[model samples]
Target: MGAVATPLLAEERVVTLNRIVAVVNDQVLTQNELKNELFAVRQQLRQQGIRPPSEEVLRKQVLERLITTQIQLQQAALLGIVVDEETLNNTIKNIAAQNNLTLAEFRDVLQRDGFKFPLFREDIRKEIIIRRLRQRQVESRISVTAQEIDDFIATQKAQGNINSDYHLGHILVSLPDEATPAQIKAAKNRALAILQELKSGADFKQTAIARSDGRQALQGGDLGWRKSGELPTLFADVVMNMKVGDVSEPIRSASGFHIVTLFDFRDSERHIIRQVQARHILIKEEADDEVKPEAQLKEIRDHLLSGGDFATLAKRFSDDIGSAQNGGDLGWVSHGVMVKPFEEVIFNLRDGEISAPFETQFGWHIAQVLAHRDFDNTEEHNNTRARDLIFQRKSEEEYLSWLRKIRDEAYVEYRLDD
Candidate 1:
């Protein structure tokens, strides 16, 4: 009887370790995995000084997050996306550096804080893979035309608060793509109800944790500081008029209804920088090439110094396809735009001087500085900012929509006991 009881206890332990909490597509999420994630999330909330929601609410939230993450991982695998060891190591090193610790020290700290190093590394790897997958699937497909940038900048100027930044808390009641009228109404009602709760002095972060469907819901829907140009168009229009600590009424969009609270605001500083008009001819090294790229670029530089036509030479020999057709003209570049070696060489050259051949990650180049100026780059900055903001907004919406589509198509089954 004692021997039989020992085996029964071992079997029970095995069952507990392998308990299926949920099934996401082809993957089974174990009880241990869910418990670990829950622990991590609770720790994160505590560190951020936000109160954790009730256990039931938090458990559901964490489970949903795990499901979405598993879906994304499955999609990433299907798309052949992977993070290599070197990149993962480098990313971890950078993270450690940001925290003012060496990699060894960071590992020790994580271990001391009850994190398993192997699991932490794998988590970082998965994050990188997901990021790359998003870049490929969603971000690469988003485009902002020149006209859109012009319109955005013009609108900002008209609004008279181009430099203002808003720190916002948001709650989203999401609707499906092609949602029925009934669904729309239901989502709107839910958003309005949430808004009423907020107005009645319910804690915003706590409510967001329990109810919002936005990506930042876990972080209490805190959409940290955003520039005026960075806000989604719907958010920008609504947020502009709200005072600090003021919550907007539910606003509707294609994705769904949104509720936003303005937590803080501040103005941004003006941008002024040195700009250079430059052009270059690149030569890439190939095994079949008769001449090395460095030697070829040296010859091209000599030709430019000896009264040769730079544009004609660039069109004929430059390997950079984007600039080659335009006479190799890289118009009005600022610092940090070009690769380090390329920028170093270009910025050091005087006006109308052709640089000697130099190698960057992109192979060998001979660059000529056509002109330089101390420019007030506010409009240009706004153009870039607008394009980036539009891209970010589109990416967020498209990603959420895509996630919903995939989730709906997935085979998910919950095994958690009621």
Candidate 2:
């Protein structure tokens, strides 16, 4: 028995291997996934009739995109952010509506385009989750203080750019990285020539397409509507000095030379703000209710006229549950927040005047205006716009930095190179 055991041999194991392009943290990205994504993206570009980059460029870009998406999705899962079925369905419906198609037709189109509807739905769900995760982590973290907004507004006012909206046209003569003096001069001369043509009543868009090297050259450099502090630094000050339909001289930046045309300008925030402190007792109609809602509202109104407490009556009878618990108090509401009919009545009402029972989309309503104030909200609007612009600017910067930080910190292994 011992001699027979000495002759025993070990069994050999065989393995099958598939190519992995990347290893991100604990997850691996397979070559098949990369190839499939690249194919889909190329198909999309072809459908749009846009020229795609070379195979090498496209592969690198697509792989980078996939890796970034994978990192964000992992973060989303760790943070418990999920796109539920109902929300995903609603988003799909909205997408269909935006493309002027019904749900059935949208599915049909997807099938015709060589996409599986289920996979598309999953992709949309993942995209939404990633978006929500980014907003939670990056965009929501940006804060613009009241003092910052005030300072921005004051600076714009000093620059004579307060509350201004400009319809802008731009032509950029771009320079490559690390350009020599001669190249810079040539770019500047090109910009100057374009400026001369623009000032001579030549079509700004046509000139932009034919000669401008701007990113929006394809769209004829139309930079639709922009508010003060929203323009690029090179043109911001120059544009403030220009009237509608005026073109500027060549302006130089690190990336390029610019020539801007002010197609239109307007004082967008010059409006009187009439705000009201009001309360309402809403009675939304119920389908099963036998009594007429209008008659019930009238009874409630009569009770109020007889010195019944508004808060108590609202708590007991008001159907607008949101304000009812707070004694039907709608606090100070500014213009454009309420329905048109509601606003019309509220603005016309004198302080302490209860409106007659009136029908709005939300059934019949009786309201009382506690106070009214009229003031110019132009500065306020400007401050809000400045805050928004600053927030947007900061968010973009922070988002890029955060993305880079995550990417750099991730434990990525390049298996494809091997």
Candidate 3:
């Protein structure tokens, strides 16, 4: 009430209108970032011909996705996860090549499309870092046992699902964010009802158009020809069990309930490779020796062909200590196990015939094929395929669960309402 001078600070302060939409740990997501992401999302949806949910739904979904990305980036930074300049540049260049544009043209195109070049680089760098993080933290934890591989191979062979491709149809009954148990139950019931309709001779495509909440719903839910490791783990085992035109039971996921149909199937044949059993005498070059490695190997080959015992020469002169003691026996060499130069020469050799000395990175070698066979590697082939499939399936499952665990543990705050 004293008419003294009023505080002068109020007149000098300027307020900024830029809003923070979300808080991810110590990082704040501003309105500009949210708008940019929403714009990108809308463009993507339009390109995909997807009928996205309401604007509010789209905004919430996009915001949540951004939050997850932000949290991951923050975690990556804490762990010192980084993508080197060379790798990032190469990755970008490869992407440009894939899009049929040179790197300079790609930069121009991105700018023309309203994306800043620096921002795009950062996005790609983040992606590579996240992939590396997943490989280190998630994939490394997964293990495939010898017995597991054998069993998996046996099962796949029995089911004839190995080396098969599937054309699939999908239907999703999506639940709301933070869906309550009651809502989940309702979603499941809806999924079951749709499944029943599908089984009762309702046209699957027509039903999908009318009912599915999937992004591909308008396209009759058709997921065209996918091979092993190309599909999400949710569909791997289920699809294998399904006959063409058969619909699956509802499968639960973070988003919703999914129902899949096997629209078509086909078998892809495996390849057979020839193998050789061979022996070699390798002589490494000595810098101080008057005789060169090549000349030494040639002399050894001459002695062998002139009736010197192969085993005695190998033991006396061969540098391959492990095989030298065993008379230079390489056991059985497969198509790809040995170096190309060595393999090419050895593979062409007639049984019990010595070859002229040849050079490989490992030094000089003279070889003889003791035996060769037109081996049927179908079982081994299937086992390799099965091992990969099982590892991929298990790793994908573990990756998702690990991602969810990390996401849940992070501290997030919403400021959008304010």
Candidate 4:
């Protein structure tokens, strides 16, 4: 009887440590998980120089985010979406490279910053899974037609704010799908109240942290810089007339009522592409050859520098048959037209200045810059930009709608206080 009582006591301790915070469908979120997420969020807020809200307010916000994220994860599992181990490792390596660290060094840095390396890796995996899920579910469904692109471009031109960019702060008082008139009025009234607070000099970020339902609520509702064409049609209409520092009235949309503050605005300068007229002679690497490609190209470059005819030498020995016949003339090349290694070598060369032998994926090359120009590509740029912006605007709208629909359908039961 005493041994049985001892086992019961141990089981009670385990239950106490792994107390349930929330239940979503078939899974439960534990208290420890919530605590860890809360700690991470506080650290992030501090790093961003934003004061963390009161614990009570933040806990609710974090819990809601956790629930939504859990729902997305469940859906991802159901749809057979996963991040392979190799892909996850490669992503971590890329992140480390971006920060100028090796994988081991990155792990050390995480440890030094008080983050468990295993936890960080899992977090990255989850982020990748969620991103892929969004791509598969929301982004794949959106489309922008040619007529829409044409209309978008024309509208931007007529508005005279085609080149304008806006940095906005947003808050959404959300409502359920097919909400009743009473719910609509309630949400509108709530949005209006929040707007009045902003107008009366309340801190927009703090207010958003406390009340907003937008995806970026935890980030203080800040919707970083966006071109005019990238804004939702509803937001574009209201924002075009807004002055910097002005808070907008609640704008209605399918998701909910929104309030936005124009934090900053700027005009993009005219589109001018830097074009480099360059040419190169390539010597494709051959495993059977005793001479290495780079060494061979170096000898050729020395000959050209020693008063040899470039066109004659290129036509005689260059491996690129297409350009070799044309005296190795590549014509005018823009920034993104060539591979990175090739562009780096050619773009940095002065007119008539030849590069030493360098290796790209196509083997080895020696390049010469003929001339440079700043070409006005405004019309072409605008057309491409318009198409992209229309796609972005549509994607944002659809993603928000999709998110709301999923949240509405998910069965979430909170046991935070219990």
Best-performing candidate as measured by TM-score: 4
Order the candidate numbers by TM-score, best to worst.
4, 1, 3, 2
**The CA-based lDDT of model 1 is what?**
0.89
lDDT for residue 363 in candidate 1, whole number 0-100:
86
Q: How do the residues 144-255 of candidate 1 rate in per-residue lDDT, one tens digit apiece? A: 8989888877888899887788999999998878899999999999999999999999999989999998888889999999887767768788899999999999989888
lDDT of predicted model 2: 0.79
Task: Give the Cα RMSD of candidate 1.
Answer: 5.5
Task: Return whichever of 1 and 2 wins on lDDT.
Answer: 1
lDDT of each prediction vs. the true structure? Answer: 0.89, 0.79, 0.81, 0.89
lDDT of 4 by residue, 41-136 (tens): 887777778877789999999999999999999999999999999999999999999999999999998898778888889889999999999899
Estimated TM-score for each candidate: 0.77, 0.56, 0.68, 0.89
Better of 3 and 4 by TM-score: 4
Model 2 residue runs over 4 Å out of place are 1-19, 43-49, 160-293, 298-336, 339-378, 415-418
Q: Local error of candidate 4 at 116, Å?
A: 2.6
What is the alpha-carbon lDDT of model 4 when measured against the actual structure? 0.89
How big is the positional error of residue 49 in model 4, measured in Å on the Cα after superposition?
2.8
lDDT of 2 at 195: 79
Q: Which ten residues in a row have the lowest lDDT in candidate 1?
A: 1-10
